[model samples]
Target: MTDLLETVIENREMVQPNHANMLETAHGGHVMKWMDEVGAMSAMRFSGETCVTARVDQMNFERPIAVGDTAFITAYVYEAGTSSVKVRLIAEREDLRTREREQTTESYFVYVAIDEDSSPTTVPELTVSTEEGEQLRRAALENEAE
Candidate 1:
């Protein structure tokens, strides 16, 4: 078993012109790619096996992360099945100098663990060991409902 919090991964990407759209904000595809990479990392952490994305839930972009801003991403495994892991991902636009951030995108992704033979493999059970972990799981569930 693995504690849900143990599967959490957080990282930051500095938005550059190359990752931006015509409006100078982050391109949707680039943001989704970052989210997918982070979500897969969380899935791999929980499963201890290579994970491949199977599905991506609806993604909603609430705001824009402009060039020179930071795209702060947090991904965590909240649920698991025999061979699948469900991860919640959130992206925020951060002004590094001001230490301010606002939600820009949120989504859920499902990944399947793969064995050396390149077949689906069983994953460890996911657990919430502490109050913080429980709260984080609950928040992800609640957000997913919206």
Candidate 2:
């Protein structure tokens, strides 16, 4: 079994000119790509195998990250099935100088563990060993219920 806390992952990226769209803000596609990478990390960390993104659920874009801002992302495994791990992902738009951040997106991603042949393989059971882990799982469930 893998504890949820052990699967937590976080990353940050500076929204540069190249990452911006015509609107002069980070493109939605770029943000999703970053989320995918982080989500896969969390899943693979939990499964201890190569993980591939199988589905993206309920991606919410609440705000945008400007070209000069920073993108803050966090992801963790919150649930697991026979061969899949489900991750909760959050993205925030941060003003580096002010040290302020506003949530920009939230989503759930499902990843399937794969063997050397790239075939789906069984994943370890997910365990909530800490209060933070339990709360993260609960929050994800509640968000899904909404």
Candidate 3:
């Protein structure tokens, strides 16, 4: 089994005007897309197979990111079932000039591995090896409560 902490993956995207809403803030849909992509990548890394999103739990937009900010998205597998992987995702915004960062969104997403036939496939067990991994797992569980 792969250590989930070591299997974590990250992705980033810049918030441009096209990715913003009329309010000039990052669009909710865009954030969701970014989260899903990062979460999927983590799941794939953990499973070593193609994966598809099965569900997204409690995605909360905590803050607004303005255009020109960079969105840093991180995803890690925290738990696993027979064919499912639960990923924790966080999106943070980095100011272009000041380089300040603030977490703008958080979510828990579930994905299922698929075989070449596109059927559900089993995945290796997830192992949390470090304090940071344990902390993220705890935070994900806590966020699920809210």
Candidate 4:
């Protein structure tokens, strides 16, 4: 079994001009792609198999990451199915100078583990051992319920 906290992944991406739109804010597509990549990594860490994005749910862009800012992406597998892992993701806009961060986007992504033949593969059940892990699971479940 994989613990929720063990599957958590956090990464940062500098928002270059190419990553931004005409408004000088990070592009939605670029942000989505980054989240997908991070979510897949989180799922693979738990499943021990190659994973691909299967679905994205409730994606909301609450704010934008401006050019020259750092985008902090966080992902974690909160639950598992026969072959699918449910991941919770968050993106925050960070100002390195002031060390302030505001959440820019949030979403849930589902990934399915695949075998060498590209067939869906089974994954171990998810476990929540620590308080932090349990808290993440509960928050994700509650958001899912909404």
Candidate 5:
């Protein structure tokens, strides 16, 4: 078994002109790419094997992250099936100087662990051992219910 907290991954990306759309804000594609990468990292940490994206439940973009702001992405494995890991991902826009942050996007993704032959492999069970981990898992479940 893997503690849910052990699967958490956090990453940051500087939103530059190259990653922005015509509106000078970070593009949705770039945000999604970051989410996917972080989600895979979390899944791999739990499974200890390569994982592939099986499905994306939903992606909600609450606001635009403008260029010059930092995009902070967080991912954690909340649930696991025989071979699939369910991940919750959140993206925040942070002003580095002021240290202000706001959630900009959220989503849930499912990843299937794969072995060397590219076949689906079993993954460890997910457990929430800390209060914070329990809260995080509960929040994700509630969001999905919404």
Candidate 6:
């Protein structure tokens, strides 16, 4: 089993004009790209194999992030199956001027591990070691709701 805390990963990107929409806010597609990239990284790190997104359980965009703000994306592997890893992802926007941050979006993504030949690959079990890990696991369970 692998400790899910050990699989937590974070990535950051500055929102550029090209990443903005007609409203001058960061485009939802661009944000989803960032989330998918970070989530894949977390899944690969947890599974030690290539990963492909199986499902985006939920994606909620709470606020808009304007161009020039830094998008901070954090992801962690919270659950695992024979070949699937459940990841929790959070995206926050940091105000460069005030140094304040606001969560802009959140989602739960499921990824399936794949072998070199692109076949489904088994993944190690997930271990929850700390209070935060337990909390995330519980949250993932609640988020599943089925």
Which numbered prediction scores highest in lDDT against the true structure? 5
> Regarding lDDT, does 4 or 5 come out ahead?
5
Q: Tens-digit lDDT track for model 2 on 17-38?
A: 9999999999999999999999
lDDT of 3 by residue, 1-146 (tens): 98868767877799999999999989999999999998999999899999999999879899998898899899988889999999989999988689788999999999999999999999998888889888888887787778
After TM-score superposition, the amount by which residue 44's alpha carbon in candidate 3 deviates from its true location, in angstroms, is: 0.5
Cα lDDT of model 6 by residue, 3-120, tens digit: 9788989988899999999998899999999999999999999999999999999899999989889999999998898999999988999987898999999899999999989999
CA deviation > 4 Å runs, candidate 6: 144-146
TM-score of predicted structure 1: 0.98
The alpha-carbon RMSD values of the candidates against the true structure, listed in the order shown, are 0.7, 0.8, 1.1, 0.7, 0.6, 1.5
Name the lDDT value of residue 13 in candidate 5: 97
| Residue 109, model 6: Cα distance from true site in angstroms | 0.9
lDDT of 1 by residue, 9-85 (tens): 99999999999999999999999999999999999999999999999977999999999999999999998999999
lDDT of 5 by residue, 54-102 (tens): 9999999999999999999999998899999999999999999998999
| Shift of residue 6 alpha carbon in model 2, Å | 0.9
Off by over 4 Å in 3: none
Query: CA shift at 35, candidate 4, in angstroms?
Result: 0.4
Q: Residue pairs in steric clash, candidate 4?
A: none
lDDT against the true structure, each candidate = 0.95, 0.93, 0.90, 0.94, 0.96, 0.91
Which candidate gets the maximum TM-score versus the true structure?
5
User: Could you tell me the TM-score of candidate 2?
Assistant: 0.97
Candidate 5 Cα misplacement greater than 4 A, ranges? none
Candidate 1 — which pairs collide?
none
